[model samples]
Target: MTPSISVVIPVFRSRTLLPHLYDRLASVLDGTNAGWELILVDDASNDGTFEAMLALHEKDHRVRVVRFARNMGQHHATLHGIKRSKGDYVLTLDDDLQNPPEEIPAFLAKVDEGYDLVIGKITGDKAHSLSRNIASRTVQFLVGKILGKPKSLSLSSYRCMSRRAAEAMGSYSGAHVYMPALMLGSVPADRICNIPVAHHPRLEGHSQYTPRKLLKLFSYLLVNHSSIPLRFMTIWGTLISVASLGYAGFVLVDVLANGSAVTGWPTLVILISFMSGTILMSMGILGEYIGRLISENARSGQSPVFEEYP
Candidate 1:
């Protein structure tokens, strides 16, 4: 039987919080008149998180578990569960219980209202570090500008997406799996909506989102999702080419009119260095894009499953 909703949670060393998260999700989901299932995806957290997930599956057959062969980050783990979801609506949330499972209904409410994607907007005080908060803001701004998302809507890990929205993400096979960027691209701006949800402090351990991970995600977003970097290089390259031509023309006019060139040889050397650096930078950008393309086309598997329990 198909469930009305499928809850996809990415687990990473959150063994202690699993019991509470499962209980709350079950409790809230049971109240609604909809069939639901829970997908617990372990992002290769070798710290025995899969054991807890298996226990939950034993307790309730509605629970599904998948352990990756290696760590693929939270977004990759989530896309795996979402692909396995057999529900009308695919809901995602943090395993730390920061975004309460109780907020599931609010997201569902918007989904029921025909919204393709319903994201949770953190209301009141957010329980995160300044850097994490800044990263989140930076992601939202970039998504808005690059993906043409509405400024009014916000992005969060806690959200509900319709089956169509989930299916639309099938084209993204690259390693750069930015969930929000893919989602915003899949659904139209008008179809995406946001509802306020309360955010709480962590229940057990620190966030899996470290500074390095955040920067990596940002880098992938810039390179994989948008062509702005290439465009910037192209524009600057053309301008620099024009500037070099103007300088060459100046040297020509000076040699013809007076004696040698213009003034100091340092100016010509500086101009050469500047243009060479820009050319090198542009080549590097093109190489990165080409490398990613090769990686994308030659892809063998995605989120390879090590173990999955019934």
Candidate 2:
């Protein structure tokens, strides 16, 4: 029977949680109206996650396993699973138990309301660190400003997408995959809805993401998804020029009114330093755009190598 829903879980050294996760998912999906299939993408997990998945598949026909040749990022694994899915709707979530399997029904319920996307929003205390929480808030703020939708909600990896939304998202190929930004670009904000989901402490290994990774992800979003930084530079350059002209006028007025030299070497040095810094910053932004173009071209020339599952 064709599955009505495909649940894609990207696994990377998450073997310990698979048994528990699979059990919970199987139990939750048993009573649902929608026929379900689990798409487990093992991103070259060294922890024998592939073996576990194979064992599960042997016992159950609804489980499908796709093993990657090497470790791709979580987004890549997600994309791979989605591409391999054969269901009318797709749900992507972390392999960690933090996103409970029980909440899958809630997501499906929201999807039934005719929304293209349903995101599980984490609110209140959800076992996230203070630093992570602050960083996430900052990312949400910047994403909203850049996308020109101040109210655009921040989306987690735990989301449900209609077939149309899934296919639209699968077409996007970028250096970094910011799902929220991609969804916002491809679908209207009103088409998206959020339901609060239960968050649990990680039952297995630690989080793969670090603070540095978070910053790099944010930088990628800023560079690729929005031109706000470039626009900010333009505005800043104009303001600096106007300020310098005003300073020059003040100096000339002082010279004329008091019959004295208007400045010292210190003033000249400060002006030169300011201009030099501004020039470097402007060049840096240009270089970022150029680098992205070059990278895109390089990626276009090559096919993504993947190891076939045995």
Candidate 3:
């Protein structure tokens, strides 16, 4: 029988917290009195995470587990998990205890109100460090602006979507997987809504998101999800051309008024340097876009799932 809901979580080096997370999910899910399944996608967290997932499966048959042969990143893990789910509704949550499983009902409530996709916006102060918080906000702001999402709608991994939306998002194929981008692009904006949810401190370990990962995520959004780069390059190149023309007229005036363009070498060199820098910058931006295009088209194999619990 198809479960009423499926909870998909991507785990990475988080074995220690799995038991606690599972217990909370099991308790809350039981309270709902709805048939549900927990799908845990271990993203090659070879640090005994698979063993823990298997332990959960042994404890409860409703706990499904799949471990990647190699690290495929969190979003890829989630996409796979959701695809494998057989549920009328799907919830994606972090493995960390920070995203309380208790909040699941709030998301369900919103989804029941005709919302196809309901995101859990963190209420009050977040428990992340200042830098991480800033990075999160920056990414959220960029997503909202680029995706043309409403200011009231915040993006979070702790979100719930209808089975129809989940299947629609499965149509997405890319080398880089940004969940928020995929969610926004796949679902209609009008059907999406956000509700306040409590965010608690981590029980153990720390955030796996390093600065490098955050920057890569930001780059993914900018290059893969937005045409702003090409548009920016166009406007930037046009302005540079106009500047060059203006500089040429200045040099012409200097030559005609002062006999020769000998003293114009300094400004000429400056202009050349500026133009060179702009050209290189534009080329770099174009290269990123082309790289993503080639990547998505040329992208082939992925790390296989070697283990799944019954």
Candidate 4:
């Protein structure tokens, strides 16, 4: 039977937590009215998480597994599940066990309210470092600025999307694919809602979302989703050029008035330094955009799955 709901969890070095997660998911999903399936995408964990996924699949027919050939990022793994899931509505959550399985019903309840996408908003305490929390908020702010999502809308990995919204994402082939950005573009803002969900501390392992990865994600948002960087560079260059021209005019007028070359080592040094910095900054932004374009042209997000379990 085709499942009415599909749960897609992207696993990354959570071997110790898989068994408990599977059991909890089963318990919560068993009472649902609609048929459901668990689709676990192993994001090439160096640990034995893939083996555990295979074991879970063998233990339960509803558990489906996809093992990636290489460690594609979490979003890529989620995209793989989104494309392959055979359910009317798909739910995606992390495998770190921070997002409780019990909240699945709340997400479903929100979806029943006619929203095309219902995100599980983490209202409870998140046991993370101060830096991590700040990074998350920063990313959210940038995403809102670039993708035009509501700054108030707190997006989590745990969200449910209707088939229509999921299908809308199929047309996207960008390398740095942020699922929430694509989702915001695909679904109307009014139709997207959030439900409060409980959050727990990590069960065993630390999060893979290091500071570096969060920065990388931010960079991806800047380069892939918006041209703001390029626009900023253009504006900066124009302003600097105008200022330089004005400064030159001032110097010319001073020389003509005094009948001597306006000579100041400090002024020359400052102008030269400012102009050089502006040029370098503009070049760096342009180079970043060009690099993104080249990567988008060369690489497709369609990662290869080395194995699958039915």
Candidates' C-alpha lDDT = 0.81, 0.77, 0.83, 0.80
Query: Pick by lDDT: which candidate is best?
Result: 3
Model 3 Cα lDDT, one tens digit per residue, 1-310: 7799999999999999999999999999999999999999999986899999999999899999998998878889999998888888899999998999998988888889988899888887679999999998898789888867788888788889898888877666666788887777677778898888889999888899999878888878887677667667766766776676567667666666876536667467557856765685676567567756744552332222222389
Task: Quote the positional error of residue 87 for candidate 4 in Å.
Answer: 0.6
Task: Write model 4 residue lDDT over 74-181, tens digit each, in one string.
Answer: 998998888888888899999988888988888888788788899888885467777887887787788787778886688888899887777766556766777877
- In candidate 2, residue 282 scores what lDDT? 73
Return the TM-score for each candidate structure.
0.84, 0.78, 0.84, 0.84
Scored against the true structure, residue 129 in model 2 reaches a CA lDDT of 78
lDDT of 4: 0.80
What is the lDDT for 138 in model 1?
A: 88
Determine which window of 10 residues in candidate 2 has minimal summed lDDT. 299-308
TM-score, predicted candidate 4 vs. hidden true structure: 0.84
lDDT of 2 by residue, 1-310 (tens): 8899999999988877888999999998887877999999998989788999999999898999999998667877887787788778899999988998898888888888999888888877666778877887887788777665437465678999888777767666665666666667666677888888877889756778788778777876776666556656766765665576566667656666875544574467456656765675676568557656745653453333221267
In model 3, the Cα lDDT at residue 89 comes to 88
